[model samples]
Target: MSLVSAVQVRCPSCNTPFTAQMHRAIDATKEPRLKELLIQGRFNLAQCPQCGVQSALSAPFIYHDASKSLFYCFMPMNMGGSAIQQQQQIGQLTNQFVSSLPPEERKGYMLQPKLYLTMQSLIDDILAADGITKEHIEAIKQRAALLQDIAQSQSVEELERKVKESQDKIDDLFFQTLDDYIAQAQEENDLETAQGLSALRDEISLLTRPEGEIAQQAKQLAAEREEMLDKVINERDQERLRTLISEGRPLMDYSFFLALADRIETAQASGNEIEARRLTKLRDTVLAMIDEQDEAARQSLMQAAEFLRTVIREQNPEQYLRENADRIDDAFFAVLNANIIEAQRRKDENAMKALAAIGTVAASILEEKAPPEVRLLNRVMRTEPEQRRALLQEERALLDDRFVALVDQMISQLPEENADLAGELRQLRDMAIDVRAQG
Candidate 1:
């Protein structure tokens, strides 16, 4: 009997090398189908001995100078019409399956199966370029066929079975081919190719290892994104509150009360029951101020109102503080009295005494011999329209200059950087000069 020379190839899975014997002559009677299948590049599950990964290898039927051969020639003219016919048949079947899905679902459905097939095709392309042995090629073909079956299966059970079978075949083919390729490399002294193939096998093995670092990075990114979103939400809420205050929303003008409510709501939302309860008590204190009808209590409420107005105007300078300037002036004077009361409550004796002295001096002057201009100025300064027109000519004359002087003093006392107040005071001074000229 003649000795059969074995064909060897490298295994992709375990980096082992193995060999399979090449048949010298086709056994037409004993296994006719086997001969045909070998020519057509078809095989069943063949696993790697090292890792049990499945694979398939089959040689393509070719003709060389009127003699049947297992390998195809490089020249296009040497290729038989039968090879082209088989390729076309496979393409048609693939197209038919893809076209069967609905338009909307088609892309997603095809994508999943296509990914597996694409990976397998990449492996085949790499092996084919390396000029792997017939046994390795046949093993790859069997693995590809099994992967195709897995992709096409609709039911989970069918898919699982196909996957297991394909894995088994892949193991057998990869281990056997790897063993043969390593042996061949040693024999031929191709150290570089051996190292490269070994690295590829090692990379495949790493796929089963836990990707803890990757998972941790993903979680960190997610948390950062969530924190950024929360910050944006809080900024939006504060902007809404500012807008409401600037718009002179009636309920929002009570800053102490509104702030209390805001704190309570925020605390509750954050699940801080203790903080929410404390804020609720603060809200009740503000409500009590509004409930009292006495002059002292009303003055306290007015100070809170003026403080709210100041806050709104300062925060949103572009917004108009008052539609009616005269009404605003009267309101300002009324709120001053409230400020004194608030200052007294806080034991601000200096502020209260200073305001009281000013009030006393003004009252004393009213009792003295008043000029017409001074009286008229006093009338104009009054909060009520009836009081303004009740002024005698002599009283108007006497009070006008004093009123201008008072306004100048108040303007000088304001913060130097208060541009809005400075501008308004300048206009008031001009108006006073115009009134004096008319007198």
Candidate 2:
């Protein structure tokens, strides 16, 4: 069996003290026995055990022990004292109550009643005399006991269910009171007050409703937004695809060869041999049609042909020439020569006349009694300085024999006393021999 403690408590209505067990006091509820006693007010609640006269009990009369195992009733001092003094007195009384508990139970009870009583006294002060009825105090104590029992409940779900049931009963009562107030207002023709009260009631009802309905509403809204976003995205994609197809962007052409020639060239440069070969075959097929086309068709096909040829020329020059080098070179040179001739025809008359005069003088010199080589040399000498210098060296080499003979003759003609002229002739002859040897 559990150990229990009991304390004497005065009936608040009659000011008649009586013994009440702590468990019973904490557990007091709205039972028929309690109602018949009508101990629902600080005054006129407690019954006198002898005379049965109910009288008002003063504040600070209720007391609890340290372990909260006992509640006590006592006569309090007059209201002439300061609040601090009253608190001190109550604190001493609580200390005495705790000191009276057994040492084993006193350990957990350390100063709990003092704290509870202090807080309770402050609340009682706030409520003043009008609010602190016996019924209100009893209700608070009962709620505390119910909370304790809920703590011992097996599961959170069970505890939550019980709490909800209690809250729902209170809420129903509140709504009923609000409905009655609104009705009274309406009966008095106070339309404004009635409307205000109805609006307040609606707001309170909404606040108390379950959260699942709100969550479902949010989920529906999000799903609708997602659906609209998907539709817009799909429509935009379709429009983009259509525009690309209409503008000839080649989305349908999966053939790698249909790609731009520059792309093929780049692939070839990057050593993508397979892509390069495929592109080359496709380009050749396209270009082969040019040979079968008429002039107008060929002209219309200029871009495709040029692109194919450019890729081949830049990527594989040898192959390009093997295929169309002769034809392309002939066309290029013809245009080049035509441009040069046109420029020559536009030459100044004075420059032309100067060239003609030089040519005539050259022809007359070629008519001299010179070797054919010398004639050719003289003809070249008019315009070629390098050829003139070469011919002069050749002539000097051939005259070496004559130079030696003339030097010997001049040495003989010199007088025996005129040795300087003989020395000069000898020097000339030696220089000529050196030139011949070098040549």
Number of the top candidate by TM-score?
A: 2
lDDT of 2 by residue, 30-82 (tens): 12122112232232244468556654434443333232243443324454578
Q: Root-mean-square deviation of each candidate, in angstroms?
A: 35.6, 51.1
Q: Which sections of candidate 1 miss by over 4 Å?
A: 1-259, 293-409, 412-439
User: Which lDDT values do the candidates have, in the order given?
Assistant: 0.45, 0.45
* Model 2 CA lDDT for position 264: 70
* Local accuracy of candidate 1 as per-residue lDDT tens digits, 1-439: 1112356745678878766443322222233333333333432224467776756533221111111112121112223467666466334433443454346523432322211122234334434444766576776666545544544666646654554454546475554444444433422334445444454444333322246854674466456544433332244354453443333222322333444466679999999998788667644543443343234434544554554355334544223333222223333444445445544533446656655654444344443445554455445555253333334333445435667786687678887589786676566556666645667
Model 1 TM-score?
0.17
For every model in order, what is the number of clashing pairs?
58, 5
lDDT of 1 at 392: 30
